[model samples]
Target: MKKKLLTVAIGSAVALTIAGCNSSSNSTDTDTNKLLPKDATIAFAGVKAPVTDAEKRAILASDATITTGSDSMPLDLEYNVFARSGDTFDHAVFGQLVDKQGNPLSKEDGSPSIANSNEFTSLLPRGERLFSVSQFESRPGAMFLMELNQNTENGELSVKDAWQIDQSGVNGGWVHCAGSVTPWSTHLASEEYEPNARSLVTGADAAADRYAAGFLDYFNGDESQWNPYQVGWNIEVDVQADSGAAPTATSKKHYAMGRLAFELSYVMPDEKTVYMTDDGTNVGLYMFVADKAGDLSAGTLYAMKWNQTASTGVGAADLDWIDLGHATSAELSDYIEGANQLAFTDIFATADANEDNSCPDGFTSINAGGNGQECLQVKPGMEKAASRMETRRYAAMMGATTELRKEEGITFDPTRSKLYLAMSEVARGFESFKKNGADSSSYDLGGPNHIQLEGFNRCGAVYQLDVASDATIGSSYVAKNMSALVAGVPATDSYGDGVQNPIVANSADYADNNKCHIDGISNPDNVTYMSGWDILIIGEDTGSGHQNDVIWAYDFGTQALTRIQTTPYGSETTSPYWYPNINGWGYLTSVVQHPYGESDSDKDTGNGENRAYTGYVGPFPAKAE
Candidate 1:
């Protein structure tokens, strides 16, 4: 196998960057600016024309039924090494919840694993030696793990022998989004959201904290067991070789890292610093710097505040981190107790903590209490209980910028000291300031998260931020959005023909007017960069514009975006991960999330199609040495 070198245009001269480059330290030297070929051109589009029998069979087995279509491993990709070295040789991909006896594990309700019928799920593969596939079970949510069996002669990769490593009731899981495989070989799965269930707890003295009632109800209204401490935080699993078995693998819920509608965890090369995002209307970006490397049990969480410099949503803006303070799991538990015992007002003050005078009239904060660290004061009337438990609210209280809609996947470019995040959609006239909404100023930043302008693509977008290299520990670090890209086809006269951004009004009009413009992959969801190659893979979770979600690979240097694969209509292309030189293959793996509906069952449809598939495609062109 030869190492392939890519020549990119750099200051009137070509710079070479190797593809599939992995170092001995398990880190990569993937430089986006030097990875694209100098003459790289955008690939032209063509019809999806039906797939071959072999291709279709690889995705839809003889047992699967009740599906209109399936797309796995298109021509541009191949199976990763993780898929090849599996125990079975059927070359067949598997879904969640298969037992040791080669059967779909059933719940106490006598049903299969609670599959997210209509939600987004992220899939990530990790390992130091053997492969461990981690999937977010969005519904009745939980993270599922499976280890691939070593491949044997004539045996293709199959789940027939795969084991379900995590039990459903174990480690309290909820709806999750894109996650990360850490440098320390740990699986960090994020919990997307769970509505504040505290209001449901019926008690004479139930507290006003958002999660208070939910925790009480979880314990059957027993306030003594208010473990609202669980859920919504990042859960780290030990996926080591010997620890891959079920009931034995240890897990930790990272409480110090504030909880919110977590989207993804981006652990930096240093292994101590991490970047994470909140997914919802008016959210904030966060970073967690652990006390030490390889351990995330304790850390300082900071929220990002963006200073709007221009009307266009894109371009660089001044960024600063607000120290939100730190707390251990035990400290959070004690705070929850104090918040419940005392009146919420006594614990949280309505006046401004910082006398800088820029604090709004309605904002709230608690006394600094001389914590010895410069902490950012939160919103007016926000309780400390809410800050640690209901993190988004605390972030807003600290004067951290909010109103980030559906902040999703996050990935880092260590070589460039940059981080890219996905804002799934930026509705017209969107504003991060949620309070006193009518009076709040709405500024449109450029990129996929803003309204579509003429000749500008309107869908979702990605933002690039420059992270300071020598950011001091426990001090505010500065970062800025250097650029943003709103996605959609340039407003062309042909838009009316449904060749680009199509209009369907609603689901009822989908069939007749279903032709969607897929030229530009819209409503991007999961994003990951293949180091050395500098290829960024953007996965879509959209059911509009293009009902069939697609995955696109954007060459950073060449600026060429190519659609690599498209999922069945109504199905989301979630968690498209790219890895360099996996089993000698540059592989990409994705999950076709709930393609059709639950009605599409495992009946004999004669066509042998299913609504779901975990696609494995790879061994793509490795760098030639």
Candidate 2:
């Protein structure tokens, strides 16, 4: 159930030049149609932040649908799935009924699909199994989220069976890449975030896009036996998981998030943790804390070095890193518990998506799209998921470094304290990732498919961090004008292969816009990716995505995630859908946020005025008591 590619290209209007090491003077102007930190202030710090004058006329006069309740928030679900090859393995749990514009009213004729389950076979004790849709049909304030799942359960996550959580379990089958969602409640589901290029050099072709439709190779080995490059991303599933969970064979590998090519990890309401460097080449932004996890007990993992950049730019010299002189951060977190080192080879010396190890070979276009390229084939020890040998000697050894390279969407900020980095591309700052001409090895990417969109140069950025001290986002002007990073593709899907940037066409969502930072704030309270505003969004059914792969919502304000509402979703020739990929979702790989509530902008006030509900986006209908 993999396939989710998110890039940040940036090349429109062409004719530019810069990356040749700016040296700073704040941004030594060479001018190639402009845009380098060029005073746009790096993009945007608060976008405007000045609001005050009576909260700017009450967001210019209210009615975005301000809500705390249109009603329906009660859920009791337990859909699960696992079992890949044969035996009873059918995996299908479905439901769809949307409204409020993202559409899909099922067929309006009373929109339906209500609740579903495809009878699971047996993954055992905690491998996966649980289902109880909250009466099904949705719409109240609308947001019956999550839109992909192969084995359903944890992947479809929607349960309230009063609440179970057997210590957190995992055995394993195909929940292979990416997971983490537990501020307090629990949604760690499984583990899987497949992709391994290590040094492919950018020919970029993850299979024509449409979200790559669930790659299916059926694992036997070759391209490097798929990949397990060490640095594992955790997989110990099974706890009664509110998720009717799935995917387990014998899962048991959590050496504290480290092992290149690993994906999915985020927890903070003080749970203390942060991960997602995904290095096949891409580093920087890797952290771990756990003060006291329901498990881990303790914590230590850090890597996020960035400084030395004044080649003429003028500002940027508070930099820090070069301290191998003694190695501290608690002796590299006990030196990985003893160094059997399953993954995260150089901890962070990781090659280059710009994390920095001077990537000559390792870059970062990554994969998991195109239905996982006919069943996955970008191998290298299963693309390094803790370098398997039964979990790479049980990695726990602490320290390692390539000096933080080309990092990607790792999370943490909803109060677990702070850490929200996202950079399959970052290095010029503002004028949207500085690229008039580039030359450290070249990196200028522009807009379309692969990068997910909404506005500007195909925009590719979501960098915000405060993880208390690891900090980040101070560059200013709201991160250099920031209105960029939008190419979740779909400039228009019309149907199937419409193909914009199409690296899998786009649908892994930075925030189906229910405004999920779940407290993982990648940039100011989960900078909710905006483009049609998001009431609930998740797309995939084909490359460049569009065959009814659904989940949508829109229109919100104050902080603005905009999706207004939805319920009783419908769909006919097209445009009115209510998802039900089987039991609950279909072939998914990642979606984390358990224990929930870690906010930044609910924007409520009364004493002096500013009661804006953070920018309510309205339209909540569909009900079924």
Candidate 3:
């Protein structure tokens, strides 16, 4: 049998093209037909990890049995599956394969543990192979064989099986996290980031920006094209289930989808609007206004920012209609020289806390054509930091030379009008050294400081966001009005049914974190808990790289955060976090919800579309008796 390749949490991404378009104008199409919401936003970043029972309930409760196309379909089985490429996240290979006993398979040494009795056929769905001990056998219940929606001619990894469902395209890559069948009979697949970029980008525009220097590097400059240039986008996959090919790439680029890693997507019962999330951690949060609402083609983009309580400020607003509206390649290079200087300057400051070199030599604003750090950018060398410079030096440590967000996992509740966000576990402390301890001396980042002030929020947590069902809050969540509902406090148990906090060195106070679970809330209006408008899902990784596969829930109305009933991290290759951590591959890629039985998500049935279905990013927690 062939080895199984684990997928990244935030694997692929795509770009939207909805510029000046009003999907409402689709009067030409049948009145029953409507485009998806282009103006969406994700308000989940820098939020604390969940710790209470309520937070855990949100994730488990999301699986309620309501409506279903087939009574025989299993809708409430608490399912989790692995994600593959969607043309956006181009990891080595993606997806999860486990055994019937729920035991995880291994992907060690660049190879998976496949017993001689297992099957190993390349073309999925068609060529059959009986397996005795393969990733497939590790699954709990009956397994569904899904494949990348690309043509066989495209690459070696093509779906050769006689499978059924809907979705396909040359790059008909499926957005792992978010998926929804449109009211118009199409499915919406989310593209997290630009796969072509390959490595994560620490600085947004590499063309000019470097560390945090103010001067340009005359020597060894420009030749490497060290310029931060990446062709990427957030795309929607149209599920033409009728044909084997679904989620067509022809979907328009939602201009409303500001700029960031497109994490998840959701639709409302009204069937005229959609919602999305920017899975970029500590980056931004926002919402968009679809020109015609749901027109996916064109719409106005906006972001949500929080003002101090009673400060009387505008929390949500779209960025200026600048030439390079979204994160465009053109604007990234204008001040190329200035950018490089700024980057190196910051790097130097991190090595040694010398304010003299803190402010680079030539990093003047006027030189970069009005392009500089977006105020929200994190600067090194702070007096009140919790750890050493290595804490904030993500670029140098992780190949993230440009992008700095490891954000992942996002879901939406149309009925409750909420979003559920989760992030990977924190691998290390705020310090560069892989040690975990709370010195409170190196806690200086904008978002990091805010989290420390709040008691509970520690490592590898989840958050909730209050948002409108029709608002565009996904792709542009960076500037969103973010508020931490749940604090990521550690647990009393360490080796229990919970995830581990990667930064254990700084977390001496939180040693017994076994029972510790980063959770979120849902249906906050309940008398016992708080109410959440939408749930945003995201996670943080410990410096160790051991991914903790857990989900958090939240409620917008009561302003409460709940924890989900997650079992624990699987220590095998078949486990959820294996690929992203062990293999040093995959990401918390994307979080999405599709209809039961079929991989299509429909919201018209109402926010109360109480239908049961199984969704997975890993193995299903519903262990069979």
Tell me the lDDT of candidate 2.
0.24
Q: Please give the TM-score that candidate 3 achieves against the real structure.
A: 0.40
lDDT tens digits by residue: candidate 2, 159-272: 222211111121112223333445442334223333332322122322222221112121111122222232233544333334445422223445444434443455544454
Q: Give one digit per residue, the lDDT tens place, for model 1 in 1-625.
A: 1111111111011111223322222213333332223232222232231133222222211110011123221222222222211113232223333332234445568754434322232222344234554554443243434544323221123332333444333334556666777886667877776444333233433445543333232233445533333567787777544444432345676777877778878788888888888887556788888888888867777877766555443223567677787666555544434454432333343443355533345544321111111223333444445556666656655667664566788887765777778777654224332121223223222111222222222366777778776446542223555357435442223433223334433344333323333456566788888776666778777644554566777777677676666554345667776555433334466666654432223321433233355544443433322
Ten contiguous residues with the weakest lDDT in model 3: 577-586
Instruction: List residue ranges in candidate 3 displaced over 4 A.
Output: 1-185, 191-231, 241-259, 265-276, 308-456, 459-462, 468-487, 492-625
- Tell me the alpha-carbon RMSD of every candidate: 11.5, 25.1, 17.3
Give the Å error, residue 610, model 2. Answer: 16
Deviation in angstroms for 554 in model 2? 14
User: Which 10 successive residues of model 2 have the least lDDT summed?
Assistant: 566-575
| TM-scores of all candidate predictions against the true structure | 0.67, 0.25, 0.40
Computed on alpha carbons, the lDDT of every model, listed in order, comes to: 0.49, 0.24, 0.26
